[model samples]
Target: MAPLLICDNRAEVERERFVPGTPEFRRASLALFIASFLTFANIYITQPLLPLLVDEFDITPAVSSLTVSLTIFALGFALLIFGPVSDAVGRRPVMFWTMALAVLPALLAPLVSSINQLLLIRIAQGLLLAGLPSVAMAYLGEEFSPRALGLAVGLYISGNSIGGMSGRVISGMVAEAYSWRASFLVMGIIGLVGVILFYLLLPPSAHFKPAPAGLRKGLQDIGEHLRNGSLLKAYSIAFVIMFSFVGIFNYITFRLSGPPYNLSPAAVGWLFLTYSAGTISSTVSGRFIDLAGNRVAVILGVLIALGGVLITLLPALWAIVLGLLFFCFGFFAVHAAASAWANRQARRARASAMGLYLLFYYVGGSFGSTGLGFLWHARGWPGVTAGIIFMLALGLLLGLTLRDKD
Candidate 1:
């Protein structure tokens, strides 16, 4: 065999590929936007409910963190599988159907009688949820032109930011007003709505190619992509950003709920609204990175993130909220850039590369959420803040090394 054709047949297909401004393009973008929203919202719904879990289960912070961490951990492993599987089968089927299946676990969450049962249910949902992110990244690379990739990726991420905000905000308010169970039910219903819309709206993949079926070939393809230095560096950025991001959000609730501030759950949930900055930053950052270069864009994003972390050290509520705003923007900015860059680099094994990226992304998240809880428990808010800033500093260093200047 002549070194197996990768990159698929998309170049020939690209003559008629979806650009940024066609009816088909608009529909694809909208569908992906909705898909991104539903995936992220479902994944993070348990975050704001952590305090309630702590109280109800009488577990330690690290233990309570498991609800989110274990799900992410499961998601991490599942990404490695789902992405490759989609490569062999098809993107459309994998993207929409797995999402539909995930709603079952979400609906079951509220009905669980014990923490263990709830955790098990969440873990199952996490596994099912993995098909969306990796497959979606691959779908973007296949369907859109390089010119539109950055902006399209940004739009997708903006949906992610908003979905995350909605989940935190809605869950917190519902949990505060009624109960955690009520919040889970609400998220399940919302997820179902998004799923239906995604299935109906997303235009079929016009440029997709089916990879060889089986786990062995998928692993081989994944291994080939992993050896690229630039891709590996991009993967590091994914891990660091997610580690710092998820860990911070995981524990910030603990600080606010128990502080001299003594904020209510609803009020704490309002803090996630700061994520709106991400909505703007991700879109602008993508367009900017497309025009400028990845090096400057990545560095600028990391610096902004560092500034955000430093601001949280201040002792005022207004200052904390502002810091979170900066943090949200910075993370989403880098995420849009890095995710686009990663997809672009794969040129060949796009799905495999995306799967690997998310693998590190969520695995790092799993570790950070639980690992940082020790800092939160031992040394309090100041300690947790320092740890995150340290990770952000590392991410900044890695960001400086990216060679993809497109």
Candidate 2:
């Protein structure tokens, strides 16, 4: 498919961007990094608490997974609106206020008296949380110098790994020690602090030019992106990889918390320490993409992830831990590579493009969390493994079709 044409004026395209070693560059990078960290942390805080929620609320595993699924479900659709809104207005304010508002839901979560109430709070939080991720990538793609773009994007994604891991770890530990409600309170405090830092650190957009603002314009922009075969492949890759990743993590809690293992919530949460591998891989992937290109990075990630999934089939706890590390390593590599590739491909309406990508990303997560929860409920880990393997194979097929940019 032909690339979408949305380039700025020739002079603007050639202008200087936030470069490494500069104070402004440092501030922008740190700001977006924190944006990503807080967004993912708040979004995933309930993951490890799923079992506890189930027990406390007297729900099934599939129903309990909705706490995580519904949040992502709302975030996915919200990206559609937030992306274009940011493009019409500005990236900074959208990110700032949404993050600030999201903290309210986290604080409210502790007061939720019913499962329905908790899900509503989670959904509201998801809507507010979309502001950062939906636009942060577009902001970086528009503002950062081309040479620095991959690195900036990589570092930003590394925050996702660290945030997801930390949130899960903290929630699990805190929930076990005190109560699950306390876990929400702690995450809210952290999110509030992150919002202040993000506001102070991130420089206002210097290069952003306004796009046409309206529902019709936004929908049209989305349509153009949808028509591009290359962009679709990237979106498909996102869906499949996230499905596999969320599917494993969601069910693994149940797997480890029962029967042969019988690990506590805290111990299970500690297992997410394996996400450190993703942190390392995501950071290095920027440089790797500079050298090897997107196709290779995606293919490599898929193979590693597949191997990791297989390793978990072994009964030993060590085997499960090793599998998770490999899965995380592979997951982030594919995610970072695909994310950067999609933005680079977008000629205009960059945020809308990223929004489309995220819609698929979280929709995949929702399906995995809920779909695999049911599968796990019915057939256990083997069923979940079979499901992930199928999705990964599909992802590999799509990954193969993505061409390196000319």
Model 1 regions more than 4 Å off: 1-15
Displacement of the residue 105 alpha carbon in candidate 2, Å: 0.5
Could you list the CA RMSD of all candidates, in the order they appear? 3.7, 3.9
Per-residue C-alpha lDDT of model 2 across residues 5-24, encoded as one tens digit per residue: 33555445646688778887
lDDT of 2 at 360: 100
Q: Which residues of candidate 2, in runs, are more than 4 Å off?
A: 1-15
Highest TM-score, which number?
2
List pairs with backbone clashes in candidate 2.
Answer: none
